[model samples]
Target: MDRYEGFREFVHGRQQALMRSAYLLTGDASQAEDLLQTVLMRTARHWHRLAGDGNPEAYVRRALINEHVSWRRRLRRRPETPTAHPPDRGRDRGDESLHRLALQEALMRLTPRQRAVLVLRYYEDRSVEETAALLGCSAGTVKSQTSHALGRLRVLAPELADLLNAVDPQEVPR
Candidate 1:
């Protein structure tokens, strides 16, 4: 098959996983969608150059991380804007949703880079080396960020750490 066809297949196969990672990074569906679209567009533009690379997924993931970091930096440079509408006061769904909401809030409390490291390491199940490559940092940085992020999470929500550690593997062995 041609390089174009191969690149097409590669992108189609990895799109969903990329979107999930983007969602976890941004925490906003619309922003994630836009982020993924931008990444895909940039990837497609360089497909000819990247088609020969064995690790196209890694390249794409790195692009996503760089884009997210750059966007966050730009956002920080802007002045804080007032919201047109008041904060939502919707009723809680249930215990699970409430727990999830608390987790999301805690995630927001982390720095963007810390959140990215945690999501890539734990949520995406990436190794320190992989996350380091994606973030354009060293493996040591990934390890340190993961440790610090988890430490912060533990402080913010000790109950979550307890619940996570309390899972019994033998009860549901695959």
Candidate 2:
């Protein structure tokens, strides 16, 4: 078997999902592309070792989260100020699109860790223990962060408060 065949298969099968996670992490399509590309390159380099591990998806996910957090830290150290105004997005498609945009903007305002927690727990449908494991934090930390993040989101995007409150109570940590 070709040594890289497994890596190729993995990328082919998972790129879209990985890209979605990257987009959620960076909140920009271009940045998400760059982030996914960088992580994929690194994963390719270590594919031999990673393939033997039963959970390459988890490894790649942890890498994505770590790289995103690192990028945020680096960005803080060397922030850029855009002089030009962003191009207008034109009329909202409808109430749903507007709500989605509001939620996304509110997500951008969250700390990277909080955003990561929310993405993993809610978006990815991971359990609190799984999120903690992926994040290298205690389960209690995941629970608290998830609680705090949802609270902050409620504050940041009051318009979505009803939708946020609609999350299944069973899914949220007490």
Candidate 3:
């Protein structure tokens, strides 16, 4: 087998899924592409070992999450100022797309850690323990972060209130 055959196949099969996670984590398409590329490059260096371990996807997922957090920290140290004008939403997208855009905006406003918890718990459908494990935090911390993140999301995008209810009625604070 070609030395890169396995790695190539793995990337082809999982790239889309990983990209979706990347986009969710970074909240920007270009940033997500960059994040995924950086993680994949790192993963490629360890592909032989990771492939033998039989769970490269998990490794890549963890790396993606960690790299995202690192990028957030570095950006915080030298944050860019936003323009006075918000980017136009571009014509009427109707309610569903508008809500999605609103949710994405609110998510971007959250702390990287909080956003990671929400993505793992809600988007990835991971359990509390799983999220905690991925986040290197206790289950209680995961639960609390989830609650706080949800509450913050409500404040950041009140229009998403009803959609948030659909996410987990018990979790969204009044």
What does candidate 2's lDDT look like per residue over 35-93, in tens digits?
Answer: 99999999998898899998999999999999999999999999898868887767587
**Better candidate number, 1 or 2, judged by lDDT:** 2
**What's the CA error at residue 89 for candidate 1, in Å?**
7.2
Q: Which has the greatest TM-score?
A: 2
How many residue-pair clashes does candidate 1 contain?
0
lDDT of 1: 0.80
Q: Residue 2 deviation, candidate 1, in Å?
A: 7.5
Q: Sort every candidate by lDDT, greatest first.
A: 2, 3, 1
Error of 1 at 42 (Å): 0.7
Q: Per TM-score, what order, best first? A: 2, 3, 1
lDDT tens digits by residue: candidate 1, 4-27:
657778878998999998988887
Q: What is the Å distance of residue 20 in model 2 from its true position? A: 0.7
Query: After TM-score superposition, what is the CA distance of residue 61 in candidate 1 from its true location, in Å?
Result: 0.9
> Which regions of candidate 3 deviate over 4 angstroms?
1-5, 81-91, 169-174
Comparing 1 with 3 on TM-score, the higher-scoring candidate is 3
